[model samples]
Target: MASALQYIEETIICAEILRLMPRFLALLLRALIKRCLRSHEAIYVTLLPVADQRCLERDTRNLGHDLPKHADCIQWIMESSSRKAPWSGKRVVHELMAIWFGSVHALTTTVTFAIHDLCLHPEYTEPLRAELEAQYIQFLKSGRGLPLLDSFIKDSSRLTLVESSILLSLSAK
Candidate 1:
């Protein structure tokens, strides 16, 4: 299981299509799409066995070995209000993809964009660092965040969002 997972980890999320000369880029995009899809499906196929095992004993629906300890998100999702079942292995795998995108993907992408933007706009670096140092002291004193840092983070996130992505921005007080 570990070796198989290691192999999957080693698989590149996308092939080197961007490096191809301009003319070939268009042609290779389709191949890149296919490769990504296959990689995605490979993960689903890998998890089918575990999902099947978890679904087998619905009465005791405890996916983890440790009793009363918090189980992993996959187990929680299976038990969540939306998923009542006699769960098929395929359904479990599909749900895995859904849960991952909503939580893991969103968080990683948000952090990635935030970090990338920080690199792109070096002017804000010192100010943000100083703000964070000040904020840490303030937090220890009163557990409150300063408006300047909050607004900056919110605005940075808002600006970094892609055109096609939907984001509802709530003003930070």
Candidate 2:
């Protein structure tokens, strides 16, 4: 349902098809719009309370990076929306919903691809599991921990970051 909304936006850009195929476009648009509306309603119900909390925070201004409570992405979007023309409740809800839809799409795609890759190479699964079990926390910025997990995800992305570089260099020397 959420994904249909994304496709509908893309479909709207080519206006010729919309004009040429009224019945088909109308059916598609009607269905997607209905789904989007339902998604909006569900997210709005969840986000209204958070927006209220944001309004409460507006007066006190716990708006600093130093503040521990200011960690939520939905809160950040609400705070950063528009100072000149404050967004309506509906607009805010839509924004939050859009963010959630994007996040969920990314998560699902990555997980799907990862599962496929893991199945393609079964040998790394146990070592990767062991690496995760040994580490309680990972500091990805400094690369202080969880090298195996990092390499597992990003090694295919970049050739230089692989652990086998050391062995290759030793063989050459």
Candidate 3:
């Protein structure tokens, strides 16, 4: 269980790092280039056009197959683009990247902080651990049917979010 938690923490941190990489690179570019290269602008001008083309081609190829629906950003881009006056691939890519970064950061932060809170409040630890064990397989299969785990995560997230807001307020002074 300890190992599992450690693994999860490491995975979340790694994912968070990966999710921020574009912004980090853009910051580096802004620093080195001596100009304000916003991350989205940098990404749009550099790589997203190619990705958008690839995504469009793939979706076109899979039009008849029973594939999962497109991601929201990609779907919107496809809807907006046409034979003429096409949507900018950069915008599509930027929106997708933004969503990825935001979702990963929010989820990882919530989970990490909640785990920290669980550590501090040891009384809830055993019950939570037991609940996790019981629900682990089910969660793996259906990603649901874990009310206890959900409640624990929500409670932990709430407490940690409140604490973080307080800390942020203090530090801003």
**Top model by TM-score, which number?**
1
For candidate 2, give the lDDT. Answer: 0.54
Q: Write the per-residue lDDT of candidate 1 for residues 47-91, one digit (tens) a residue.
A: 888777666655354464443434876577567634544567667
Error of 3 at 88 (Å): 3.3
lDDT of each: 0.55, 0.54, 0.55
Query: What is the descending lDDT order?
Result: 3, 1, 2
TM-score of each: 0.55, 0.40, 0.46
Clash pairs for candidate 2? none
What lDDT tens digits, residue by residue, belong to model 2 across residues 1-173?
Answer: 65445432332322223334466664575455445434345446666777766655654464553433566775677677777665655566666665654555445544555666788889999998888777735554455888787777675434222213322221122
Model 2 RMSD in angstroms: 14.5
Clash counts per candidate, in order, are 0, 0, 0
Candidate of highest lDDT: 3
Q: Give the distance in Å from residue 167's predicted Cα in candidate 3 to where it truly belongs.
A: 16
Candidate 3: lDDT over CA atoms? 0.55
Off by over 4 Å in 2: 1-37, 41-76, 102-113, 126-143, 154-173
lDDT of 1: 0.55
